[model samples]
Target: MKRIIGTGLCLLVLFGYPMTVQSQTLPVVQRFVLNVDYSRFWQNDSTMYIEISTAVYPNLILLQQDSLGFHGKVELNISIQNKSTGAMVYANRYNVPIHLADSASLVRTGSIVNNTIYALGSGEYHVSVIGSDVLDRTRKDSSSFTVTVQNKPDSLALSDIELCSNIIESSDQKDVFYKNTYRVIPNPSCVFGSTSFPLVYSYMEFYNLNTNLMYKITAQIVDAKGNVKKQRAHLRRFSLPNVVDVTTLNCISISSGRYTYEVILSDTLGQVKARSRRPIYLHNPNVKAASAETIVTARAEFEGMTSDELAEEFRKAKYIAQSDDNNTFEKLSTAQAQKEFLEKFWTRIETEENGKSNLSRSSYLGRVSISNQRYKSMSRAGWRTDQGRIYILYGEPDEIQRFPNSGDSKPYEIWYYHQLEGGVQFIYVDLTGFNEYTLVHSTKRGEVQDATWQQLLR
Candidate 1:
C-alpha cells in the first residue's frame, strides 16, 4: 500500500501494474522502490488517454533541504514501443523533483506520488520506465509491461476500474487528482484489508448511454475461481449521454483472498451492456469470529458443510482451544452436532482473554502461512517444527542472534523475547547439518534449561 505523506494520511496513485528491476546494487533497497502504472480511457478514435501514476519510496533517493522543503531529484526515462513494427513510438527523459511529504519514509508509510497523462492510438504497446536517484545513479530501478489500447464501442461503454482509498467531492480545479467534480485518490497497489483501507472505492466513466432508457449498475466482488462473493446493484437514469459512476464496497467482513471488483451496465430489461474489472488483494484479519446471535443464524449454513470439514476447521484452530473443547468436538458424530459445537467454540473465544491472546481466525491462519515459509523442515510441516511452535505461541522475536557452525560447535540461533515473562531466550541448535535446528535450551520457566546444552552443539 503506497501512499503520499504530509498532505493526507497516506495516498496511492492507482494506475496500472508495473514490474520492477534493479541495477545490481544491494537489492535490499528493492523493498523501498517505486511503483508505476497506467490506466487507459477512450479519448477519440485516433487516440486513447494513458493516465500514468507513480508512487516512489523517497528513502531510495538522496534529499537536500531546499526552498520548497526537503526534496530530491530523480532521472527518469519512459518509452513505449510499437509491438508490431519494432519501433519506438514515444520516448522521453526528464528529471522529477521528489518532495518529502512529511518526515523520513523509514518512520512512516509515505511515497512521492505523481500522475501524468498521454494520448496514444489504439494498439498494443510495450511500455517501460527506468528511473534513478539523480545524485546517486548506482541506485536505480526499471519497469516494463504491456499496454493494450482497446477500440471504442458504438454502444454503451466502460473504462478501466480505478480503485481508490477515497473519493472526495471537491470544487478545486487545480487538485492533482480532480475528475468529474470529484477527487479520486487511486490505490495502485490493488490492496485493501486490515490496518489500512476497510472500504475499497471505485471510479469509472460510462460512455454512449441511452438517455431515454433506464439503466442498472451492478457491482460484484468475484473470487479467483470466478465465484461471486458479494454483489450489489442499483437502478439509475441519466439526463446526459455519459456520466461517471463511483461505488464503494465494505471489505471488512470479506475474508482475506484475491478478488476482482467488477462493474456491469445493464438496461432496464436486464440486457447486458458494458463491464469493467480490476484485481484486488484483501487481508481482513481484524474481522472477529461471528457474534453469538450471528452464529445462531449461520448454524444451518455451517451444518450444510460436511462434518469432517467442520472438524478440520476446529482442528486447525486447536492451538488456542481448551482441553474440554477438544473432548467435546471429538465426540460429535453428526454435522448438526458439530455445527452447534463449532458455533459455541467461536462464540466462547470471542470473549475469552485467555493468556492475553488477541487473535482472529484470519490473523492466526495468516501467521501459520508465514511460518510455513520461514520455518518449514524437510521431515514435517512448518507448524509442527519447534521454531514454528515458539513463533506461533509468542509472536515475533524482538531479536535473534544466529551462530554459524565452526570447528567447536554446530549452527545455532538464540531468539530473545524482552517483554514476555520478564525476558526469556530460546536457543535452537542444528545438531544435523541439514538446517533442522532443535530446541535445546530456554531461560523461560517450565522449559528445557540444560546448562550443558553447548556440549550437544559440539
Candidate 2:
C-alpha cells in the first residue's frame, strides 16, 4: 500500500505479519534513505564559509496496486570540525520532506545556507553533514568535507577604531543620527582625580560588498567651536574579511566643556560611505573649585602689592590699553556714569569685603588712578590700553623679555607665567614702530593660540 504525505500531515503503515505453517510470508524492507551534500567551502585569514545541499533516496518496499503516492520525511544536520583536533567547531540542523514525485529520475535541490566565524586563526577546518530518514526512523546517511584557512599578507594594515559621540545628524534633526555610532575614550594619563576636561574620541567601520571586508576609515575630535582637536586615517589595498578592533583614541587635557567626536569611512578613491558624530561631557568638580581659588588668589595678590609695585603694574595695564586705541580711553560722558561703571567692575572681581578692610576694591581703584596718570594719550587714559586691561585682569606675569628694534626685528615683549595651568605666555609686538606695544599673540598650555589683540591692529 502507498500513502501521500503532504505538508503538515503524518502517515503510518504496516505490512502483513508472517503466516503460520503451510502459509507463505514476504520479507519486510525499509522504504526510504537520507543523504546530505556540502557543495562549497572557503576561508579567509580568520573565518570560513560553507554552502550546503541535501536529498533523500528510496529503498526497496512492498507495494500494492494503490502504492503510487508514497512519501517520507528527512532531517539534516551540518557541523564544522577541526581536522587536527577531533572537536566540533560549529553545527546546525534542518528538516525537509521528500515526496513521491521526487523519484530517482527527478531529484530536487535543497535550500542553500551560509555561516560565518570570527577571529579564527589560520588552520585547516573540516565540515560534516548527516541525514536521518523519518520513514525508516534511523540515522543512516552522512557526508563530510574539508576547508583550509591561509594567512593573509601583512600589507593589510588594520586601522584603529574610532567612536564619535554626540553628533547631531542634520540641521533640522537636533538628535544624533542612527548612522553615527562611534565611541571615544579619554586619555587616562592626563585625567586628574576629580577633574574633567573637555575632550572626545571616535571610531567607525565600513564593508565592501564585493570583498566582504572594510576598505578605509577616518576619525577626528573637535571642540564646540569647530576646531580640529585630533585626527587619524587608514587605507587598505585589499578588502579585510570583517570588522576589527582598533586601538582607542585620546584627547589632550581640556577644561570642563561640551565637545563633539566624529568618524568617517570611504573607499580607496575617497568616496564617502558612512559618517557619524558623538557628543561628550567631561565633569570635574575639583577643577571648578580650583579655578575659583585661582581667581581669589589673583585678586588678593594685587591688593597686597606695595604702592610703587601697584603703580608699575597699573602703568603697564594703561600702556596696553592706550597703545591700541591711539592712546585714548573711551571717555565717560558723566562723572556719575564713570563712578557706577567702576563700582560694578570692582564688585565683580571682589571675593570678600570687611568694611574698611576691603583691600580688593581699594587696590583696583588705585590701579585705575595710576593708569590714568601714566598712560593718558590723546583721547584715553593709560588704563584703557591693551596692556592695562591684561594687567588689571591677570596679575603681573612671572617674567618679561623685551626686544628693542633692530633691523627688520620689531620691538616686542614676551611675558611668561610659572604656576598657571598649561602655563601662560603673551607676546606683544610694536608693529607700527610706535612707542606703544600691541598684543600679538597669547598661548595657554602651549596649545591655544589667541589673536584677539591682533584683530585690534587689523
Candidate 3:
C-alpha cells in the first residue's frame, strides 16, 4: 500500500502537479531608482530649480499576463534642508502612477517631471528623494542630495560693518559688528614666489535676492602681529562679475605669515556696507636650508681660531665665513697642513684680544664667499680671480650695466651703492678673457678722479 502511494505521488510530480505540497508565499521586493543630472543650482530670487528622474521596480507579480492589474502610485518628496542648522527650509511632493503594459518592457518613465524649485534666502541646503509602492505589501525607498542657496541682491543691506581683530566693549548691546567678505592670497605665511598675491571681496544686494550687483569694495593688509601695514581703500568702486572672480584681489609683496584682511563696501555716503572675514596663512620657503652654506663656511673658517679671535673676525668681515662651501672641509692627507694654514691666516690678522683686524689684512672674507657663489664662470670660482677681489670688497652693486656680445666695447657690469660715504660705483670690464668680469674703474661721489680700480691688481 505504501509503495502504491509513493508511485502515485511520483507520477503526479512528473506531470507538473504535486499531490501533497504545502502552500507558502515569498516576500515581494521593490527597488526605487533615482538620479539627478546636475548637482549644483544657483539661487535666483525666491525660486530654485533642479532636474531629476526616478524609476521603480517590483519583484512580485500583481496580475496575470492578459488581465488588467491595479498599479500603485509613486511618491517623490524633495526638501531643502539647512546644512548648518538642520532646518527644513523648503519641501515639495509629487505622486504618479506606475501603470505600464504587461509587455511594455517592464520600464516606466515618469510623466510629470519638473526640474525647477523656488526658495527664499541664501544658505546651504539639501535635496531628498523618497519613493513607495502602494501594493498590498508596504514597500518604500528614499535617497537625498545637497544644494547651496546664495543671497540675492534684494536680500542684502549695507550697515556699519566694522571689522576688528577683537571684540570691543560698548554700552549698547546692538553694537556687535562682524567683518565684510575679504580675502588675501599668498597669505602672510606664504613664501615669496613668482606668483602675485591678491585680495578679493563681494557685495550683496540688499532685500533683493536676484540682484547680482556688488557694492563698494576696499582691502587692507595687516602684518603677522595684527598691525595695519598697508591699506588700500580706493578699491571700494571695484565690483566682481561672479563670486569665484573675487579671488583676483590678491596683492604682491605680501610676506608669508598669519594675516587678517578687512574689506569694506559702502554707498556713496561712505556708510558701511556688507562685510565678510577670512583668515589666511602664507608659508615661507624653508630658508633654513639656504643659510646652511653660510653656516658651514663659518665653521670651516673658524676651525682653529679662538672664541675671541673668531668673534673679532666675524665683526670685521660683516659675515662669519670666507667660503660658501656647504660641505665641511676635508683635509684627508693634509689635515695638519690645512689646519696650520687656517690658523696662520687668522692669527696674522688678530691685532689684540678682540680688536679689529689690521687694514693690511684681508677682512672682507665673507664677501669673497658671496661672490664665489653668485659670479662663477669658466670652471673658476669667483674668489680665485681678480674680479672676485672687487666683489669681495664692495659686494653686489645696486646697478649692473651689461655690454653683451659687443666686440669693440667689451662686456662689463657697473655696481652702484648710494649709502656708501660719497656714493661708490664699480665698473667691471672683461679685460683678460672672454665672459670674464674685471673691475676696471671705481668712482666715488660722481668724481671719477679719486676712484681706486687699480688697487685690486696690487
Q: Count the backbone clashes (under 3 Å) in each candidate.
A: 5, 31, 44
Tell me the RMSD of model 1 versus the true structure.
Answer: 17.8
Indicate the TM-score of model 2: 0.24
True-structure RMSD, every candidate: 17.8, 33.8, 32.7
Position 455, candidate 3: lDDT:
45
- Candidate 2 lDDT by residue in tens digits, 285-369: 2233224432212234444444234334434434222221211111111122223223323444364432223336566556666
lDDT of each: 0.68, 0.42, 0.39
Q: How many clashes does the backbone of model 1 have?
A: 5
Which 10 consecutive residues of model 1 have the lowest summed lDDT? Answer: 22-31
Write down the TM-score of every candidate. Answer: 0.54, 0.24, 0.24
Q: Model 1: which residue pairs collide?
A: 3-11, 4-11, 14-188, 16-37, 16-38
- lDDT (10s digit) by residue, model 1, range 267-300: 8899888788866766554454343432233445
Off by over 4 Å in 2: 1-348, 352-359, 373-380, 444-458
**Local error of candidate 1 at 238, Å?**
1.3
Ranking of models by TM-score: 1, 3, 2
Highest TM-score among the candidates is held by which one?
1
Candidate 2 local Cα displacement, residue 140, angstroms: 99
Between candidates 1 and 2, the lDDT winner: 1
Least accurate stretch of 10 residues (summed lDDT) in model 3?
Answer: 4-13
